[model samples]
Target: MFSILIAGRLPQINFQQVSETQFVIPISDIDHVNHLVVFMTGQIPFPENYGGGGNWPSAEGPSWIFLGKITNVKPSAIFKIGKIKDIESKIGSSLAPTLFSGFQHQTAIPTDGLLGISVEPLSQLDQQIQPHDITPSTVASNVEFVSKMLNNFVNYVTSFVQNVPGTSEQIVPLSIIQTWYNNFQRRITENPNFWR
Candidate 1:
């Protein structure tokens, strides 16, 4: 079983069967601005080698944008849904009823605004490789670059602040900011959940 918790509202909960791997969520009532947290209930594990993936289909339909994936290592994921462009188009019309018939009884899938989430086997996802698919090396390089850039930026800003005349240390203390940057960089290095 899987459940979706839409945060920042009345805490709506939507449930879906594991068999119905693909489904759509309606965002019209919430103004299409919220975070969706999808997670497994652990009542049933995914069949041997299966994994779950998510996608945001284009408002016009046909094209689906890859969001991210959920696996045993990372069972839950948070999706930030922002204001979608051209939301006046009819929703679910182009999408098959099987994609969202599961949720029809609880929350009616909006005809004009909907977000699609798909959970499929890892093998199926491998067949359709996305350009932005993440890799371990890519993540490491990004973190290294970010850490170096932050350090350089902090040094530059600190130097500029010190050189300024009549600038009170109380306004912006170099030590505090530098310490904070150092701590943040350390935390990110040690734990990937710092961003969360």
Candidate 2:
């Protein structure tokens, strides 16, 4: 089974099941949203011949784009929804007719301001490299650089006083801050989902 969790303005959350591998959540429900998360809950794995991915609306031809696959190793995915106007401007042209002809008759495509999400069995997912796609090494290097910068910031802050002001002893000690950062770094290294 698959489920979708949508979070909008602070403290507002919506959940829905993708019954039969398809579901629609009205745009109003997620207006001014913070994040969109999707995951699979079933014990059975996807078939060898089938893979799962999401479909997002395109501005041109009112078509849709495949937003890549969500696999068993990474069952859950999070997305930050961009503004409609920005998305329309960035998404250049509509998809080829051959790719979307089969979906022309589907009722899932929203007419009003509703957002439609679906999981389908796709054999291939446009394997050709796109200029926008980033490599795994690039991501790793970026993460490493950020981690180093954060560590430097923490060390600089800790070096200042090493104790709370106007006190004989160290209140809110430096060790605690260091320990917290170490634990956070370890958790992120082990599994990036700790915050999730």
Candidate 3:
């Protein structure tokens, strides 16, 4: 069961080409958008400054919508992997892919891309999402935030393992690690308190 984080109808949107590879569009929304990028590419739409110089759309300003559409369909693992690759290529980030249960076992040490196992559910917004721009600094911060969340999840599992009987001197089994990771991932997705 996958739910798109962003989905909805965008009203009064206008697209303009700014360069060979970039575009600018104005949107109407009443909030600050987060984590929304061009579908499939994870390309953050640059927020056009109007009336003020905020990086995101405020209740009083115009939200800039970009080309490309996010969909409601659940993305297959391969599709998600491709999207991640696209993002890494565009940002020059080296990302590795990881999968948990209910899928093929693929493992690679993360170097630049996202820790795929911890990826949140992605989807198109049914309504226009709040306008926001993606910046290198914010991307770095998001990575750091994910790392912190994973660390917290690890600590949570460690505490649980410590309570297991007669397991103090034994190696933590891979199955147990995977199970805990899945639980952590689910919790984070269901409740994105980490974003706050």
lDDT values, one for every candidate: 0.52, 0.48, 0.32
The digit string of per-residue lDDT tens for model 2 on 13-130 reads: 2323446554444444444554456566666566655555554555554455444455666676664444433434543333121122223323443443333444555445435121
Best by TM-score: 1
- For residues 85-119, what per-residue lDDT tens digits would candidate 1 score against the true structure? 32223222232112222223333444444555566
lDDT of 3 by residue, 79-131 (tens): 11223223334322211111122221222322221111112223222222211
| Each prediction's TM-score versus the true structure | 0.46, 0.45, 0.28
Using TM-score, rank the candidates from best to worst.
1, 2, 3
Q: Evaluate model 1: give its TM-score.
A: 0.46
TM-score of 2: 0.45
Off by over 4 Å in 3: 1-133, 138-143, 162-168, 187-195
Cα error of candidate 1 at position 92, Å: 20
- Give the 10-residue window scoring lowest on summed lDDT in candidate 1: 95-104
> Clashing residue pairs in candidate 1, if any?
91-111
| Residue 132 lDDT (model 3) | 20
Top lDDT prediction, candidate number: 1
